[model samples]
Target: MAMSKQQRAAVVAILVAGLLGGAAILFTGKGGGSGEAGHEHGEHAEQGEHVDHDDHDHGHAHDKPAATPASAAAAAAAPAQAADQPHVIKLTPEQVQQAGIGIATAGSAPLRGSVDFPGEIRFNDDRTAHVVPRVAGVAQAVPANLGEQVARGQVLAVIASTALAEQRSELLAAQRREALARATYAREKTLWQEKISAEQDYQQARTALEEAQIAVQNARQKLVAIGAAESAGKDGKDGKGGSLNQFALRAPFDGIIVEKHLSLGEAVKEDASVFTISDLSSVWAEFVVSARDLDQVRVGETVRIRSTASESQAEGKVSYVGALLGEQTRTAKARVTLANPGMAWRPGLFVTVSVLGAATQVPVTVAADAVQQVDGSSAVFVAVPGGFAVQPVKTGRSGGKLVEITEGLQAGARYAAANSFILKSELGKASAGHEH
Candidate 1:
């Protein structure tokens, strides 16, 4: 290239200007690089993490809505105060009365007396009787109907027996002989006293009288053995007539006829039961007790018997109690005699028998309703000034409506007698608030 003096100066000036511009660009790039590297080094030192500026700004924009300082502080304090709020219940005094809630003071009180037992009504064995045929005979007629009440010696049925007929015949013959013997003895005595007959003749007549008397006695015995009664004459005197076979049976006791086995014209054995009579004036309450209850029962102890079938309640004394438990049920039998005055207690009716024995007094007791169950443990709601609080309780033997409080609750503390559920709910609400 050809250069003039002016061209060389201009070209040289253009080259110097280009060199200054390049140095300025190099310095600006170095300063920018240094700034980025410094930021990376600081982030790594502070957080032990490599920093990417583009990603940092992207995440910062996404989290901006959730970073309110006021909301964070409020959320942190919400749970702390929730547990302190009291649970409120709106209930009037009348509602409490209707719900049966009140304080029951713990003190000595008699436990309710209740005993659950199972028994069946039965007739008094000693007062019952079975009608049996005294001799083999045919049942002529049964006058007594089922459940018909009869008195002792009342005719219940009729029976025909050949043996009875024969016995009556013998009794009639003997009566005639006795009359003849009495007449002969009277004549013999008169003759001897008057000296109008030979002494030997009078003696023979007396001997004949003695023989006739013996025969009469034997005949009377024979008649009695065959259920034959000597007939009374029309004038209510002795009429020694031969009697026919009996056509009626008599009741042996005062009772209601419960069963009749024979029918009209039916042949019956000498010992066959013709009628079953039950005296309902007194009944038996029989109870079966377990072996463990033996000590609680005694022969003279009083017992209460109740039947759901009737309104009659009876008190009875233990008449008998089996000493040994049954081999099958491991239970002993106990019997009580109850006076079924109106025969309200029927045989086979179910009855609840409660045998009362000696009472053991407990030192302290509380109403059963005051106790509640919490988490498998018994608890009581103790009435405080503001509300009811739960008090864990330990209970011993229970009697009726009262239970022995051994622990957790004191003897003098007042507790919610009833409607404890409402109090429990109030306490739960307070606890929830306190937990907050």
Candidate 2:
């Protein structure tokens, strides 16, 4: 079987062409970041998430990429894009919805401007009282304790005062003398009518009776000035009664005992503040305003108060504003009175005061939660064809619920509003895969 030279050359060329085609297929199946990323993402997502490959299906196969012109081009461009911009988060409409991320459109909104100031909760001075003993005494029994609620006219403590006893004794003596003088005056008048006594003698008895009555009235008036009841306690000396020195201190109004300076067996001065009671049904939120910002605050205006230590917040009206500024701080103090049910607004708690001003419309605004930090710059996840693209943005003034975007985001652009951290976590994973 002899073969010709031309036929042998043709067989060698066919073998060379087949070998080259196989090598090209092998290379195409092995390399492509996009397909590798998509496969890895789909596999990792299966444990906790469900990703749809519907119309947004990836061009690359799971294990081996199809190596189509579109998939290859995407694979080649992924690294360069990741280096310059945030990675495009690959997600279908169903998957994005299933992820529990609320999508909202950015547009104009009427936002009220606010001025913030630090503040503190304080006792309403109008409802607070510093109780004084009024008379020097030894505290015998102090029933009121610190942080105790008290009712109006409730006995707070008992005081034993020698000075009080002496005054009571004087009143008792004056009463006895006045009784004797009245008897004499009655007898003298009868005798004078009967002509059994001289007119001058009857007149002298009448004058003496009037002088005794005046002495009794003066002594009684003296005891009344020091808050002592003439009928209180025992007047025992030869009369079967209790000690007159015992003085009961009673609360002037219904309140809580916030301060206590007297203890059992303690000697208190006449002017000492033995107790401090305050009606805690209301509290004052106090803040300082700079001289330049005083015009923003006014009496009868409403304000918002937020606790710095917790999530408690409240609304109140500005009740007072100082007419003069502080000499050292150069600021005027202001206060807002608020109803405090359940005692939520406790005194001494630090707070944030927000004074709301007139509203203004903004061009492009979104929910406050939509803005995220990527690479130390603020950015928003914007909706693209198949997924969200990271958009760097510049932020302006912010209301509590909405924020104004000055650059990089257009009106009517849809963005993640709530639960956006899920997208942020996925973005971080995609970036790490590229680095590896």
Candidate 3:
């Protein structure tokens, strides 16, 4: 297979060119395949990224609906729980007895319409007195003490009065002169009858006797005006050692001595008040009525007086009502006279006067004690399955033993009529525990 040099060279050149062309084609095909594969892989990666983003958005959308139902379920369950767990107080039968709890059914009843006014107990002015010394004197002895019960004409105190003494002295002197005059008149008459003396002399003696008798009478009247006791002496003279200065201050009527100003050996004036006595067997309940209610508080109207300090009540009639209104309060004064047999009604005690009006029927009425306060509203405790539940109410007129329920209560409902405050206390304790 030896050939010439030119032919061999030509063949080698052709072979080298062919080999170079094949290498170029193979390199171009491999480069094109790698570029196409890289482009396809990039497209797939972008598409996968878009698909992952869509799945994340879809998951968020599903989560929103799911969360709504959970919240709705929780809200729905809240009301059911509230319905089951109302404010309740459980008590056994023994506990109820120990607590003195009582229950009664609410029903229709008639309530008396009434108007209440604040009042106070005061002394009956008709039976009160202020004792004064009639003459200037020194208090020798004080026999009546403050708060001592005294009878009419009872000696309250003894006073040594010079003015009274002078009056008595003048009476005694005049009486002596009167006795002498009487004797002289009798003697003059006998002389004139017997002709033992001149008629002119007898007449003069008679005139003198008459003048002396008038003077004695005048002096006796002066003593009587001064409240001086009648003398025991034969000639209208004091027999007890002429102690005319001793003046006894006596009570004017049966009463209790409420005040005393005179003390032993103290000088008092002629018009000085020495004692204050009051007959406390009865008292006046004085009340202030507004101008709007003045027409209702007429004299002679019957009223019920209840004490605010204690559970005491009395009945009386209106004795007085002031015609004029007070300037400061714009109210009129009214009073009721009540008999105080045991003296239990003391002055200065606060009271309420209830004047009854017409009565009216109410749909639902409960005992006054059954009403209690809950959450700043009037409420009544109603019997329930487990215990008692508080029922808020609106109240209207109240009188005697019943109160009208305007709302929040129904007829024939059983409720705690007595000792209802126990339930209130128990409910308050439970509420406090939950808060803590």
Please give each candidate's TM-score. 0.59, 0.66, 0.71
Weakest lDDT window of 10 consecutive positions for candidate 1: 232-241
Off by over 4 Å in 2: 1-76, 81-103, 170-230, 233-242, 381-390, 421-436
lDDT of each residue in 93-154, candidate 3, tens digit only: 77878998898999998877888999999999999998987889998778799999999978
True-structure lDDT of candidate 3: 0.85
**Model 1, residue 9: what's the lDDT?**
100
lDDT of 2 by residue, 318-409 (tens): 89999998999999999999899789899999999988877899999999888999879998988788888888999987787799999999
Clashes of 1: 6
Write the residue-wise lDDT of candidate 1 on 1-436 in tens digits.
8899999999999999999999999999999999999999887777644345544657766545655799888988887656333433345657667777877888766543445579988888998887787778887667679989999877676677887667667777777877887798789889888998888878888888788778778877775554446552211112233227763567878889998898878999878888999889998889898877787778988787878777566788889999788888999988998888887888999988877655667667778777777657888876666555667889886664688877887768887887777776666766676665
In model 2, how large is the Cα lDDT of residue 325?
88
List RMSD in Å for every model shown: 10.1, 16.2, 10.7
Clashes of 2: 1
Pairs that collide in candidate 2 are: 234-242
10 residues in a row with least lDDT, candidate 3: 230-239
lDDT of 3 at 279: 91
lDDT of 1: 0.75
Q: How many backbone clashes does every candidate have?
A: 6, 1, 0
